[model samples]
Each structure stands twice: as structure tokens, then as C-alpha cells.
Target: MLASVTGKGVCLCTILWILDTKGVFSLKNVTLSIEPSVVQYRNTSKLRCTYDLEGDALYTVKWYRGSLEFYRYTPSEKERDKRKQAFPFKGVTIDVDRSDSTQVTLNDIDFVVSGEFCCEVTTEDSHIHALNNCKSMVVVQLPEHPPEISVRGEPFDYGDILRANCSSYRSRPPADLTLILNGITVNQTEPLALRKLRPTDYSDLQLELKLSDLHFQEGQLNLQCVAQVSSVYHETVGLELQSVRHPVPEKVSAPNTASAASTASSQTIPLRLFCFTMLCFNAESVIKILIKTIPASCVTYYTVVATPVCDYTDIRINSLDKFYALIVVINLINIKMPHNDNPK
Candidate 1:
């Protein structure tokens, strides 16, 4: 009876081995992911391909770009030459020295490198080996220039529609734009593709915003235009408008009016001239000017209005919050043009 039981145990073990060879007991698992799924063209950045394997004797691991094999890792290979290749494809450089069974390294990635990357795994033994695959897409972006923000209609003024156009040019996969008023996102628009520029891989995004409802605090308004190309890439530009208040002149009696006018004329013109000089010194980018007469002040109060002409990218997050504060300051330069007989 004991001999019979031993024979039965051996038979059962054989059956289980046959089942494992036929893949009945296969429990192999493989997973893959790429670090920094996005890359900027012409920028020297590294990409890491990492994978995890469980429950299978790895025969060969392969990395492919859109069905084109670029890398292979073999854990069972004894020959170093058969382990990995530095340049599997022409002009395709893989850092084989840093690569191993679980991860591969790629350096100096460019626009041509964008594609779906897949990792494939196969077991050593054909009878029981499980085949698995995992894939992730990568995006290579062209260097994006700062978005250009221009006023669409009449220049910015209190209580009027502030229509402006914001555009970010020469970026891959276009950028989304947002218009902000005094720290609040007033409006957001989808990216509109512009005419393709040079380096055929890049595109532009243009968006327009019409701000009808704007809140002015202390006679000042702040506007910011933000562009986002990807989760890792974005930029902003800002502009501000301010209204200054000056004391009104006290009315003078008829007899003293002439004397007062003469004295006012002498003092007011120089003050206006000084104010004009100060305005020029304060802000260099004075793009627009609106001239008006203030009857209360006797001397003309020139609201030295300036419009934002350009946008520049600010990458530092610590400084981004203070971006609007640095918007060009508006200064009122009360300049009195000498009264001449000829209107011209």
C-alpha cells in the first residue's frame, strides 16, 4: 500500500508540471512607464524607461518606438556583446552603460523622437513563458515663444469693453490661453491654430477675450494673459492702468481773476512740464497717449495712457504672483502746449 501511494504522488507531480508547461498556471505580470512623458526639442533632456516584472523567468526584454525596435535587454545572456547595443538604430543613441534589465536610458531626445513607446517581455521557456506588453506615448515639443497680447479694439479705458487678442506662437500641440483681471480668471478660450511657421513641426494658438464686466479698485485695473502649452510649460504677461487725482483749484473773485490767472499760468506750466518729464522717466513703454483738458485745474491734465505692446515669459513660480505688479505704470504728464494763433 505504501509503494502504491508513492507512485500516485509521483504521477500527480508530473501532471502538475505538464499543466504549468502548457500555461495553465501562468501568473506572469509586466508593467512599463516613461519618466517625464514630455520632452522639449533641441533641449538636452534624458528619458528613462522603467519596467517591472513578476512571476516569470525573463528571456528577453525589448523597447520599441512605433513598432521599430530600438533596444533589447537580455538577463540570461552571458556574452556582454549580446547584452545591449549603444546604437541600435542609426542616429538613435541609447546609454547602454546606464541601462540594465529593468530600465533603459536615452539622452539628447529631440522632436524626431516623439512616438508611442512600448516595452515587451517574453519568458525563457516557450511551454510556460507568458508574453506581456505595456506602452506609453511621448510628446516632443518645439521651443515656444512668449504669447503676444494686443488690444483688439479701442485701447483700454474704464467702463468699456476691453477686447484683446492673445497668441502663443511656434509651439507643438498649440497652447491654451486664459485672460485674468485682478487675480481672477475672467475668461478662458481654447487654442486656435495659426498659420504654420517655419520648422514645420510647430504651431501657434490665438485667443480673444471681450471683458465687458471689469471691477476697478482704487481707479486702477490689472490684466494678465496666461498661456499653457502643457502641464509642465506655461507663461504670462501683464498690464495695469491707474487714474490719478489732483486737487481742484479754488474759484477767485472777478477783480483778482486776472492776477490769479497770470500767477496760475506761470506756476502751472512748469509743474506740467515737470510731470511730463517724470512720466517719461517712470515708464519707457508709453505706446498710446490721450490728451484732455481739465477745466477745474485750469491747466490741462494729460492722462498719459500707455498700452501693453509685448509679452514676455516668466518661468519662475515665486515671481509669477508678482507679475501684474510689474505691469507698466501709468503716469499723468500735464503738459501745456503754448497757445499759438495758427490752429495747425
Candidate 2:
């Protein structure tokens, strides 16, 4: 039975459809529409169900969802049999309100249960019926962490190029290199350079820092260098800018050009200064002096350098060719020079 109507005709049809009692039942064109078809994580995704009925005899209607069911009766099921108004909606049902309603709600959603839902309605008019369908899906993603740094080398010394390099050694992805010197930090976009780590075959990453011009201090110098790579963790090793002490020449030898009469003076000055470099002798350190007079008299004096008094003079001007060094700090008085003949 197809009932098409305008304004007044629609009202009349509604009244007749509601008042019909003894007519044959033929349920057809039971079109259903649900509100939402998709959902989000932890959010409530549901649907609003609606339908279009065919004839007046299609009174008793039932709606079946996935596994649960519900029903609504016409002409007031108050007079109908108790067994006739049975609803498929019990404990595991949803949206059980309003006539011509067939909506279902998905509660407490996760990544597991994302699929389609059906809205099946049956008219108990001993004839035709209709239903509808809807579906939804949920997606998930993971998180990530930033990078870190580290360092390597034998040791550091004064005048040694304190070679310090920067590398993103241990990282999931190769790191973007950065450098932090003193108090300033270098960004990644700059033309950063990292020397190839020249470690032994069995070693890890290598970074170099060359810090020179170590001062003449008593204790260790406090210096440091760190490597900063984007994916590499932060690491630093205290560079103890060690003082590199060179070997000081031993006792000053006599002037090679000086003969028995003319004592060497100018040439012996440079030789004496060489002994001041670093004096470590006989398991201890001692300072030996090379004294020269302006009149061309040069002498090597082995005495307590602090005490000008000659203590135990080993060799000097007088002991020429008689010692291991061909020169000594002995008292060689009367050693005169050739006549210069300059008038005063």
C-alpha cells in the first residue's frame, strides 16, 4: 500500500495509518538511516536510526543490531499480547528511545574493535520488512625521542693540538652534529666539520682537541672539550693541559774557540743558558752557572747556584782537556787576552 500525500492529505493519512485495525499487514520500504558512521579513540561514536514505512498494517516493528535487538509496537501495544512487544534489546543493547529509532552506540573504544554495524528492523505484519548498515575504523601511532653525544682520545699536553672532535656516534638515526665551545653553542645549519676518527682498528669513535701554549704553572691547568651531536648523548672529558717539559742540557762546556790565554766570553753565554732549560741530575735537580766577564773571561762554576761562593768546583778555565767535558769551573787566574790597542 503506497500512500503519497500533500499537507492535509498527510494528516489524514497519518490518522488513518494510526487508526487502522483489521487490515492485512504488508511491511515494505523500511529504509533506515543512522547518524554517525565512524568514531575516534576514547570518544563515543554512535548513530541515529530513522525509517520510512509503507502501509498502515506494518504496525509491530523490531530492530536487530549486531547481536542485540529491540522492538516498538504501533496503535499502542498496551492492548496487544505481552509476547508480541518483545524487544531484542536486553542487557547488551543501546539507544532504546523514541519511535522509529534504531540507533546504536559504541562505548569505550580502542584499536581492537573497529568495524561495521547493522540496523535490522522487522515488521510483524506477516509480509515485507527492511534494514540498514554503517561502519567505522580507528588508527594509532607511536612516539619518538631526541639524540645524544660522546668522546675519545689518549690524553692532552701543552703545545699538543688539543684535538677534540664532534660526532653523533651512538644514535638510532645518524645525528646532526653540533659544537659547544667555552660558553657558546654552534647550530646545525652552520658549515660544521668532523674529522674522520683515526682510532686503531679495535677502537670506537675519535674526537680531538688541540690546546697549546701551556703556561708555566705549578699544578695542572683546567681545560675541557665536549662533543655535541644531535642524536649523540652529551659527554665530556676534563683536559688536563699538561706541561711538556723538555730535556735541559747538562753542565755548560768551555768555549770551543778560547785558547790558554784568551778566555772565551760571548760564545759561552748561549751555552750557559741552555743548562737552564730543565736540570735533572743524580736523581735530583740542580742549577749550574756559566759566568763570563766583559773582558772575554768565561767560566763554568759548579756550586750551589743560590750561594755564589764556590763549594766544590769540579772543572773550570784551569782544568782544560783534563776532564770528560774538556772544560771545568776551576780557578784559572792569570788567563789574559791579546792586545786590542784601543786608546781610552
Candidate 3:
């Protein structure tokens, strides 16, 4: 019952004997291939069914979503009619016009459409009947929104500790999460990270980066968190340090030398400028000048006085041993300097 073919006939007694005894002539090979086995919701997918028939006796091809048959093609009829085709199962949609005898196309697929699919072929013949089936798996990944980045620190600055967290919208398959700082990958080993699975079939990923004694480059550094559902699909967020209080660099000199006094004198101008920059401005104010000096050894001492449309007066005190306050009712003046200065 083999079909007519254009092949050489090797009519050997041993081959014929083995084929008859092992029932090899009745076997057929069927294979089904699905494109983009993993996909996001609302995406298109294609399925192809192929088989090698030993004999062509009105073969029928069928496609199934799980165990439910959704599409079929009969070779006996030249044109497939739409009126007699079977309806697709609930939550599944297929393009009947585009699908052919060996192919199935699903459009606008969603999370509910993910499942096992089967392709089957059967031939009609009394003595030489043959049937074959093949199965494949498909998964629908959910799309996630842009990731969110948050920082847990106050007055961000160098030589400080901080933590950053990046989180994405709920998604299936637990979006692949990564943290990159200055274009370098940060992993769980470097920072204590935590990952969790939600009860809603979603994923939650988090990373905790402990940056102790933050570096100078880190001030201008960029931190980014990226989450991906697939190779071509993902979201990212970036972070930067904010302005904060920073310790000033100290300039010291050798003890009992002329250079020591000169160095301290040159450094006082810039120190006053630094203090002026840190002051907070307000509208309603009275004149307030407070000067406190603690000279450990040999160091230069300077004083700045500010008057606001009022009479000028010079005030002096002997020692800053105890608390003292000098209040003026109309002007405000402030001088900035280091808390303690020692030469040598």
C-alpha cells in the first residue's frame, strides 16, 4: 500500500523481511514548530505542522490548544469553507483565513492563551491507516511598566552611607533585574540583595547597595537599575547624589616656623568664603555677630563685622571660656571658620 514515488527500488530479501516483521512501513514522522516559544502579552505567534506520510490516502491535519481542537484542514476538499469550521475555545483567537493546511496563526495573544499545543495527522485507509501527533509549549509573558528607583539617605555626600532600591510593576516570570553603577554591574555578592515571589503569580526583585565612605568619583557617578521581561523588552531608572554637608580640607604646617603663620593667614580668606556660602537667608532679621576662637598653638586669628544701616561700634571680649551672646536689634552678620585650629 505504499504511495508511488520516484526512487530506486532496492528489493532485497533481508530488508523486505525486516520491514514486514517490525511494522516499519506503517510509521510516520510528524513535527510541530512554534515561533517565539516565549512571548509578551498582546503579541502575535505562528505555529507550523509538518509530517511525512508513507501513503497519501486523503490525509487530515488538525490543530489543538491543549486537548481542545480548534482548527482542521481536510485534503479531500479543495476549498475550506468558513460556515462549517469549528469555533475556537474560550479565550483563544485564531486567523482562519491566513491559516492553511500546515500552519496556524494566533493574533493578539494574551496571558490566557499560553498553554500546550498539539498538531495531529491522520490518513484514511482500511489496511494501511497511519496517525501521528506532536506537541509543543508556549508561554505568554506579562508586560511591565517602567521601573521605580528610590534612595534612603539624608544630605547625600561623599564619605557617606546610602541605599538604593529599584522596583518594577507586577509581571509574570519575575522580570530579570540588574543594577549598574557608572556602567559597572552590581550583584548580590557585593550588596545584600533580596528577591521575592508574590502570591499573585508575579515577581518582586530588590537590591541593597551599601556604599560606606562614598568616593569622590561617586559624587559625579550615575546609578541605573534595569528590569527586563525579554531581550528586546525592558525598563530602567537612574539615580544621583544630592547636595549635603561636607567636611572642609584642613591646611596644617610645622610647629614654631614663619611659614606656619603665613599658611594660616592665606587659608583664612577662603575659609570665610566657605562659611558665607553655607548661610541660610531670611527676610526678617536683627544684627547678630558671634565670634568664637580656639587657638591650640600658633595660628592667625581674623574677625569680620557687618552693619545694617545703623551706628558702628567695636566690642571685644577677653576669653571665650563660657557661653556669651551679643545681640543687635537691626543688623545680621556671620563669620565662618573651623571649630579648632592648631599650628604644628
Among all candidates shown, the one with the greatest lDDT? 3
What ranges in model 1 sit over 4 Å off?
1-27, 43-55, 86-91, 126-128, 142-145, 152-158, 184-214, 217-219, 243-344
TM-score of each: 0.54, 0.26, 0.52
Cα displacement (Å) at residue 165, model 3: 1.1
Clashing pairs in 3: 286-331, 287-331, 287-332
In candidate 3, how many Å is residue 217 off?
Answer: 5.9
- lDDT, candidate 1, 1-344, per-residue tens: 99999999999999998877665445355566767667665443333444333444667777777777888887777888688744455434577887877677777676677777767766654454444455554454644577766664443444555665666665666666787777887777643444343433333334344433345554455677787766767788887633232122467756777567757655333222111222223433232222232334432323332432222233121112433323322233433344445645
- Residue 222 of candidate 2: its Cα lDDT? 38
Order by lDDT, highest first:
3, 1, 2
The TM-score measured for candidate 3 stands at 0.52
Error of 2 at 336 (Å): 65
Cα lDDT tens digits, model 2, 111-193, are: 44444445554454544444544434332211123223333332434555433443334322123444443333322323224
| Highest-scoring model, TM-score | 1
Candidate 3 C-alpha error for residue 126, in Å? 7.2
